[model samples]
Target: MIWDNNFAVSIFPILLQGLWVTVQITLLGTLLAAVLGLVFAVLRRLAIPVLSQVVSFLVVFVRGTPLLVQAYVAFFVLPAYGVSFNALTTGIVVIGVNYSAYMAEVYRSGIQGVPKGQWEAATALSLPGVRTWGRIILPQAIRTVVPMLGNYLIQMFKDSAVLSAITVVELMATAQAIGSSSFRYIEPLTLAALLFLAVSYPASRLVNRLERRYAPQH
Candidate 1:
């Protein structure tokens, strides 16, 4: 056997503790991403002169950059300006912003998918702008994109491992620490992969089910 029984038992609890940190960050990060992504989508849709252009530039820049670099800047660089965030807070914010860029695309597609006739009718009725979105546009758009947003949430959960670079001690960090110190790479790493697969596979299946449920069929 590549890993013996006693070693597996010893490491499981430690990994679980780290996994809890991962779960907390993933939940917070996904929430932040969902809200910020929709904000970006809405701002671009408004086409509000210079503001829209700036939002567009920000979205493009975030989507173009590497997330790990963003994490570094959030963790290491921000402190130089006296804008310090602890490792956990930094990880959550960085991951949230990184995923928000992709989520913005999903939100844009969903908003665009709404029937043009719906938009026209809202305008024709002289509906207040915020009321139009709140009553008509966002409801339909958000429903259409729920499954896609869930997929990003799953991706963000996996990506949370990257936070270990900033020393957040998530699941991957726990595995690496154990492996390096004990010289048993296989068990801790294997355990971490199993934990991820166990959660992500079921979540993916749930997304598929949501797509099937929500997809508009002729």
Candidate 2:
């Protein structure tokens, strides 16, 4: 049934709309994740008395939980407490927050990966903390982690399909809707997989290049 040309034509445009939504969520969610993850890394690195402890606990909690459970709670549970976000906003926030824990670890690895001598030299020069981090540390740290962060962004893009569970009309959700109505899951589902593969395969290649390019030259 799916091999029918007209059905393919009708489905392509619809899938494109779903793809756009997926892209939007991935972009915004990645932005939030990058910023929040960096903040978490800093807080934990700083090790301030209470704040650091709190951040540590949060990172563990978020990482330990399932993303789907997190999403369901954000969408379904919060509204009962008079807290509510629309499905798009809810999906974006949950994805961002969920990924933040993992990114924070990536950032921490990057920060720790920096040569200790660089930190010691900055301190010997009497550089303020902000100046040391901004002018020296973050520049090197971010570069070291760029490939890793890029990989995570690709991962997040694929994971955005999970948001469809909450009524976000992303790629998988669109496919599900089409399948439900037409009682034909094959074409729509295959189209979604191909769309994901189209984006992710090239991205995987790019990440591989970045990893090689950034690999420490012994």
Q: Give residue 119's error in model 2 in angstroms.
A: 1.5
Candidate 2 residue pairs in backbone clash: none
Candidate 2 lDDT over 41-110, as tens digits, reads 9999999999999999999999999899999999999999999989999999999999999999989988
Candidate No. with top TM-score: 1
Highest lDDT among the candidates is held by which one?
2
TM-score of predicted structure 2: 0.95
- Whole-model alpha-carbon lDDT for candidate 2: 0.92
Give the alpha carbon lDDT tens digit for every residue of 140-191 in model 1: 8888788888798789989999889999999999999999999999999999
- The estimated TM-scores of all candidates read 0.96, 0.95
Stretches of model 1 off by over 4 angstroms after superposition: none
